[model samples]
Target: YKSIIKTIKDTPLEEFYTSGHRTCQGCESALVMRFLAKAAGQRTIVIGATGCMYVANTTYYSTSWIVPWVHTQLGGSGAAALGTAAALRALMRKGKIKQEPINVIAFCGDLGCADMGLSGVSNAMTYDYNLLIVLYDNESSANTDIQETSMTPYGAQTSFSRPGKQRRIMKKRWKKSVVPMIIAGHRNIRYAATMTPAYPLDSINKIKKALAIGGPTFIHSLDPCPKGWDYDPRFSHELGVLAAETGLWPLYEYTDGEIAYNEPTKSIVEGRMKRKPVKEYLEKQGRFSHFTEEDIEHIQRMVDEMYEEWEIPGVMPIKSL
Candidate 1:
């Protein structure tokens, strides 16, 4: 990593993903793109899946990306990234292109990564190629009118999982713990982490580190959607912060075959800080608007067990030795 962004002041004054796209007013996914661009700088190729980022960022001829960007299929993040990297390596080998480091970042939404593109992503991690895959999870398939995705949290409302008289909560599945899943399923991956724009400096560090790391890496980012979550745009950042504060979304990284929690989450783990109530988090969004007191309590219980009993907190459960 040539430039390590330490604090707000240390951040680059230059903006790579400048303002031009038509993302929602409080779209944290846009922030993820901006941060990724800044961290990687100009010498990067961002492979975008057919999701919100692709649609919103490229409307007609205009685009926000300052560096090279390409459009891939809906479920093609893994294959696209690997192919691009391999092509670059081949070009360098045959003396067709300049032999230099060029960061490759392929991004996908929750559905694209956790569901559609998971197979290709799995295979990519097993390869010796250097690339980074970012899953910008808003929980729902926000671009497709807020449908239920596997990464969507339990009790949250979606177009398909809408609450009705027959079933109060159509979605009974818990949020998939993706980072840990990747860490366990793919031992060859050099780095994996969870980040949010609420902590931009920390996220920048993660992006830089992932690029610097020798092998395939993945990052799952929790994004608060004002439209899908049914909240005012103004509260996006606050909601993102609350997610970490309440342990609903943990900030952590898996590296060197070990896992570690970051910042606020680290404090919660060490007992230096207490995780706020999950109710405080759920009450802010309309997706959980249908959640009853019982439902909220259930989620709270899950979070409690995660910290008090889980061997790796949000990543793994440990009830037995």
Candidate 2:
């Protein structure tokens, strides 16, 4: 049994996801891949679905992954994960290889995981397979020229949802509820959580725990995209931090059939720390550049209702957890 990582000093210097990719500058999703790979260590097999990480990182002669990696269809991450784990188990039993536990992880973006891949992931949750599915949601179809996805945040401008004089606001739909769907529908799921790359330690620890627990697990990560979110590349990490601090995104995990909110978010809920204004979070991004005071207030009210009225913040709206 390995010891739990409590500090940055505790993390090792060796990196498993080395520098070979052609990702955008200040890409938080790239960091998501980096940290998850670091947490999973070298004894891991990664499945990359059709998305930014796969399209931008891999080529015929070159690759970024140090561990074994494979690419699957857009919505096939979960099914591929189940097949991989089952095959590993079968191989050991058949004496083709030594018996040991190996970490199996799959990563997909919002366009793949939330839109096309949703059904495959939902169905895969029922099986008792040892694997982790990470939804690295940048809120749009970024790799395919930034088209809108179901998980795109409200009032944001995308290629498909571009704003014009005829319509000032393009995207009207709220960010789709993802982790909650996993928690509610999959009764036997061992671990489910929401995190952002802004908090590296918290994100890494969550990945570690999800892998430690047996059975299929899911983690939804809100990665800040400089291009998609229309922010300066330098503020990618800060934008992620502001997202959680403003209560627009709440950090929490579901395990052992109970819900627990992480730090700062927990502090905000308990009145120890005040959640920053939504305007502060919005004004930093170019996507919300067209937002008026009324629009900002509208979003604030939605965020307020989520943290104040909902039973599990953004998960369920019941009276109690």
Candidate 3:
């Protein structure tokens, strides 16, 4: 454990965004934010949106940023990031901030990306702004106590989409696939989907690739919210692994229209790769404990269908899992 800590420390301070701050207990976004900053390096600037991350990590008196950071409105982080990228370019030309190039990074929640900042994020991609946008997808509007968002999984009960005899469904709508939607709008940038704690190495590699690509990039990150998910804080990393293993969140990257899916673990034959059932991932959360076997089966089917549709290579069918 000490060796692991030493390696993490040696990775370089410029790679993470947050250095010192107090985030809420069971909050998973903090981990991803730090990793992103570290990947973007010291010369980067981050444009944050109003969400759990913005409020919990950054307050009036103190902050966790080691780089230039800007907090934008709930629906305008992407646009703000674009403007910052433009300004930085202009500044570099005039030798203002420096003559060297820098990375412009953006961070926001699913609500900000899929709902409020959808247009702004889309436009940023369309304009081909040299920015890296990281959407912290926690499935629920966790800041508001696990409210349903368009990205929330089906058959999962939320205050907005309660499951009962009258309601009968968890979330009536399909998840808004923001990565594909962004691709449809802008063909110039790379896109990827990743999960925290589960695929840290892949996540790190993706961020590095995004920075080196020299164009706009979008990374949809699945960061488990323990408070909302009703799991022990210690289970955050395990939950992330379960999510990928269940095919609920596949570890994949889309670069310039091409898609690459990361295997859930090192190998399938070893049995180490087979993730626990979705029930293990969902059952710990009060939100999903209410689901019956039939409901569970329905959710399982959806997960399987998604894997097939995505044509995720090396992923055994859900039935096998």
Candidate 4:
């Protein structure tokens, strides 16, 4: 843990994804990409899906990616990355290329990973390719006017699920747990973890560790979107910290069939760190401003259930309402 912390603290002051891109202010996806670029270095190829990152970064007559980047269909990112990795391995084996090993990474949004690109991502995990799939989940289809995706939290207002006189409700279903779905589906995945851009050091360490582990790995990063969530751009990092502290977005990693909770989350579960109220986390964002007392109670109940499921014996007792 100390070595990993040191690696993040000692990261070179180099910007692999330089400024001047058209990403919105406080775009956490862009931050995730920047960290990934720094961790993977120059010997990497980024396979991007048809989402905000691809559209905003590679606009007409310009690009923000300094490393080799390929834009693929929304549902084709995983397949393209798998093919690239396979081709690289083939060329190296046949002595056609004498270059060092190149990392192939696919970056996609929540809609791409959980909705349109689910099959491709599942197949990639099954194939156990030497690649990394980074899912920057901002909760909505931000590129398409903030439509509600499967990963969108319940009671949050989105384009598809808005409050109206006739409906008077937001999203009805719970947010999809893609992390557990992937872990359950793929038995051979080398690494799978949940992270947030707010935790820069942890995020960087996870990316570096994923790249080092030579097998299919998945990093689900909770990227806060100011436009999508209707929050002030400045509160992005604060919201991320709140999300984890409230147990709404727990940080944990699965490696070699072992599950381990990371800091804050570990402390929260152990009762060493007090879990904050879910309302404190939600009240800051406009997306949940319409939530009534009943709505907050429901959300809090869900959080409690999650805590119960993740409780660790011999540590500390789980916090209660």
Most accurate candidate by lDDT: 1
* Candidate 2 residue-pair clash tally: 0
Writing each residue's lDDT as its tens digit, candidate 1 over 1-321 gives 566666789888889899989999999999999999998888899999988999999999999999999999989999999999999999999999999999999999999998999998998889988899999999998998999999889988889898999889898988888888898989888899999998999899999989988589999999999988999999999999999999989899888898889989999998999999999989999999988999999999999999888877877765646
TM-score for each of the candidates = 0.98, 0.97, 0.86, 0.94
Superposed on all Cα atoms, the candidates' RMSDs to the truth, in angstroms, are 1.1, 1.4, 4.7, 3.2
* lDDT measured at residue 238 in model 4 versus the true structure, 0 to 100: 95
lDDT of 2 by residue, 1-321 (tens): 153588988887878888979889999999999998999998899999998999887966788889899999999998899899899989999999898889999999998899998998987789988999999999999999889999888888888988888898888888888988899889999789999999999999999999998689999999999988888899998999999999988999999799889876889888899899999989998888888899999999999898888877756755564
Candidate 3 per-residue lDDT over residues 1-321, each given as its tens digit: 121222344565444555567666656688888778766677788889988888877778778887888899888988998899888888878877657768898998989888889888877887665888889988878777778888887766777877787666767676766766666567677655554645666676677777777678888888888776676787788788788777677676676677666666334323556545677777867667668888777777676566444334423222333
lDDT of 4 by residue, 115-165 (tens): 899899988888856899999999999998999999999979998988887
Candidates, ranked, TM-score = 1, 2, 4, 3
Candidate 1 regions off by >4 Å? 1-3
TM-score of 3: 0.86
Off by over 4 Å in 2: 1-3, 319-321
Ranking by lDDT: 1, 2, 4, 3
Model 3: runs farther than 4 Å from truth? 1-10, 13-20, 163-170, 265-276, 309-321
- The Cα local distance difference test for each model comes to 0.91, 0.89, 0.73, 0.86
**Model 4 vs. true fold: TM:** 0.94
Q: Which candidate achieves the best TM-score against the true structure?
A: 1
Model 4 regions more than 4 Å off: 1-8, 310-321
